[model samples]
Target: MAHTIQGKKQLLTRVRRIKGQAEGLERALNAETECLAILQQIAAIRGAVNGLMAEVLEGHIRTHLGAHDISETQRDNDMEAVVAALRSYLK
Candidate 1:
């Protein structure tokens, strides 16, 4: 999407951070870290992922659905796409 392209760097940084968190979680698992610590790490990773998703989703909404210049058909299509994506993500 255009918005994603515009924010590509920021999104990539988030993805890299998430990757680092995943690697840390792996290391913790291998090292047999305490259960509470592991849980906290997992929660942190999940929160990071959710934040990334929210950012992208917001961009999509603003760029596609919220644009006043777009045609009605285009807006409907974008809305459907967003709904489908949200449904899949929720599942």
Candidate 2:
């Protein structure tokens, strides 16, 4: 199913922010930042990415899957895809 353009834009913004965080990390590393500080930054970035994934997954499940016209096969596939994504990220 196609997602709304607005939803796509939101996800894109999140991904861009995560990309910026990664670049910031590279800069931190190059500057020889403190180990603890670097670790904290990494953790923060991970959390942000995880949060974004969760949001997208939630939207997919609640919106696309909830549509009354969706066939059982498509629903199952979408649900499975969400589960797989969640597992990958949680790991």
Whose TM-score is greatest here?
1
Provide the lowest-lDDT 10-residue window in model 1.
82-91
Could you say which candidate leads in lDDT? 1
Q: Write the per-residue lDDT of candidate 1 for residues 21-80, one digit (tens) a residue.
A: 999999999999999999999999999999999999999999889999999999999899
Q: How accurate is candidate 1 locally (lDDT)?
A: 0.97
What lDDT does the true structure give each of the candidates? 0.97, 0.84
**What is the C-alpha lDDT profile of model 2 across 7-85, one tens digit per residue?**
8888888889999999999999999999998999899899988888777767777787888998999999988987787
Alpha-carbon shift of residue 67 in model 2 (angstroms): 1.2
Q: How much is 19 displaced in model 1, in angstroms?
A: 0.2
